[model samples]
Target: MRGADKLVSDSLATAKRIIDPDTPVLARFDSAFYSANVAKAVRAAGVHYSVTLPQNAAVKKAIAHIPAEAWRGINYPQAIYDDETGRWISDAQVAEIDFTAFSSKAQEEQLAGRLVVRRIPELNTTKLAAAQGQLFDTFRYHAFFTTVEQSVLDTVAADKVHRQHAVVEQVFADLKAGPLAHMPSGRFYANAAWLVIAAISHNLLRAAGSVAGGKLVNARTVSLRQKLVNIPARIAHRARKLILHLPTHWKWATAFDRLWHNTLSPPQLATP
Candidate 1:
């Protein structure tokens, strides 16, 4: 579980089994998972990967080489709030440059990719003044390494796709909020098994929500459990038939009914 490179290889192999051979796969990872071995594993699997690259000396050098005209303006449909700067940023400039990653690694191990960079105007004048001279306008830069071809998706599209990695963080947050709130045992295997069960339960809840449709489709696990699973009802046997009575005027009753019907409703037979 600790070796990210091995995990990436094994995960990609598992994905290949489930996904069609012709279908393209793209893996996204945060800066923590960025490494020469990880990138090599992804490349060997013949799939594209987008990884958040730490702005180190070499990366800064490559970024510096980008021409002024290369930066194109982009505006997010919904403004993103920057926690670091404490500003609502709606627009930024994005550019890409041909770059090589893991240059310190062996020649064969070095991975070739594009460095897609986005820069937002530095709103904090106090810090900006200390970081750079007043002669130039300061901007905070965010960059990522991606093997996705420019023809398939331009810099802006690739940046958008890379940003979607935040969705995975939401999943982790959901897990922590629910079954993963506490480790049941001190043993590593016990914790691993607990994680597996938690994942399965999460998937089941998501599937149930999808079947139910409506707001429940995107509802969090907590909300889904509250609205559907934790219900006050009475079950009784009457005239050889099982009848369930739910509380009157209960909220989310329709959503529950939809889930029930969608799951248990008889399938229609094809006409001869």
Candidate 2:
């Protein structure tokens, strides 16, 4: 538990080093993580976080404290992004209403000017009714909580928080692709080692992408890997010098060159 806690803490702190001071961060975890100990640590660091709440008694009690009218009159929890046949929806639904009490201590470190975050799922269904034409159904929920007194808890803030969580899955993906693929020890230790190595690889890849995709506001790892690491070049000798030949027409070639020269270039290959 201690090791995992530190791992989560370190990842958040490392990401913090990369973000601009003006940008707000939204840390996330499962409901079990919504404890005072973890929250105190995060709050002491003055970072903002949003975690899932299990339908425990504490969380339910908290929901009970809020007026029923607050949830009744809102947008009824629609998705900001949808892939189905609609642009906007007003009557989204929840399968059931669960009451859970959870510690919101993670945000204690945040100042008054925090942001709103919401989560809604659009493609889920129970085992009843339309089982044959079963395409997919959507469900969504929204609740805004922030210490900020003056700011509006609107869609913009919620969107940022909601979108931030997508990165967590990427962490899992990188683990699957890299270190988590194998380890030197037993399965358990190998899995642990894989996580550590994958996390490191993920960070390096993110950094390289940022460097190579400079000034592009939304450069991501896929683009960077395609443009940089996946370079399809051949090695040859020109006069007494060695030369590497690859396509010259990539839009990011110049940036790639700069990235290679400034950082990723002239490195010895590691043994597989």
Candidate 3:
């Protein structure tokens, strides 16, 4: 937990160096990152954050204070497929409360933010055990802390935006499933170098898919690698030119050709 706080501060510092200082930055984290130091660092950085909050007494009490009318219905930007139950979840409800976090800290050090809570129906396991009729009746709650205010984004929009943090897990999964499957070197610096290379390769593949612009744009890293990068081709020379001949009737030949053309073609210069 202590390491997470410093990591967040270091990451934001690196981002600040590269990104325009005026550009708004948004930091997203899971509950493991919830801390006084983390919140303080975010506030000092002049950035916004949406961090999942653990269900503690303080958070629950804050949720209780919000009027029932404050809750608003929301549809997830994309359906979440539950692998365990083989189900799709597309809707939930969200609400927010004005609250101060790190209240245990010195009064000057406490941070103020909105506590956004999302609730969804819990599947009835009792019916499955009894082999009887089921009820989709009970609710399971999740809450998060966000520095965003109503003027910047209302409750519904804020919740929707925060839910998008799940996409980062997809990226982590991609890395783990690909170049990061094994750390080839025992040395710390060597492992770090491998990580850097892996990230660059991953981003390059994503950029290629984005340039190709189709279903491939959203395809996973492994899928992109198999479909586009790992292809059978032959090199030949004819008429003082080198030609790369790719297999005929390849499944992704068209998309590959599009990416190739886009990459090799020079940028057009605008006349003033």
* All candidates: CA RMSD (Å): 4.2, 9.6, 3.6
**Each model's C-alpha lDDT?**
0.92, 0.53, 0.86
The alpha-carbon lDDT assigned to residue 232 of candidate 2 equals 85
Model 3 residue runs over 4 Å out of place are 14-26, 46-48, 57-67, 80-86, 103-110, 123-136, 234-245, 265-272
Q: Write down the TM-score for model 3.
A: 0.78
Question: Worst ten-residue run, lDDT, model 2?
Answer: 93-102
Kindly list the per-residue Cα lDDT of model 1 for residues 85-165, writing each as its tens digit.
888999999999998889898999888889999999889867875764677777889999998999998999999999999
Best by lDDT: 1
Among all windows of 10 consecutive residues in model 3, the one with the lowest summed lDDT is 127-136
Residue 180 local lDDT, model 1: 95
lDDT of 2 by residue, 1-272 (tens): 35545666777778778889677665666555655556555555566555554455544444446543333223535434443524544433221122222334344432332223243444443432435664654344443333322243343544444446656766666555655555667688666766676677678878876666665324555555666788888899989988888786767778878777869467767999
Best by TM-score: 3
**In model 1, where do residues sit more than 4 Å from their true spots?**
16-25, 75-90, 121-139, 232-250, 264-272
Give candidate 3's error at residue 254 in angstroms. Answer: 1.4
Angstrom error at residue 144, model 2: 9.0
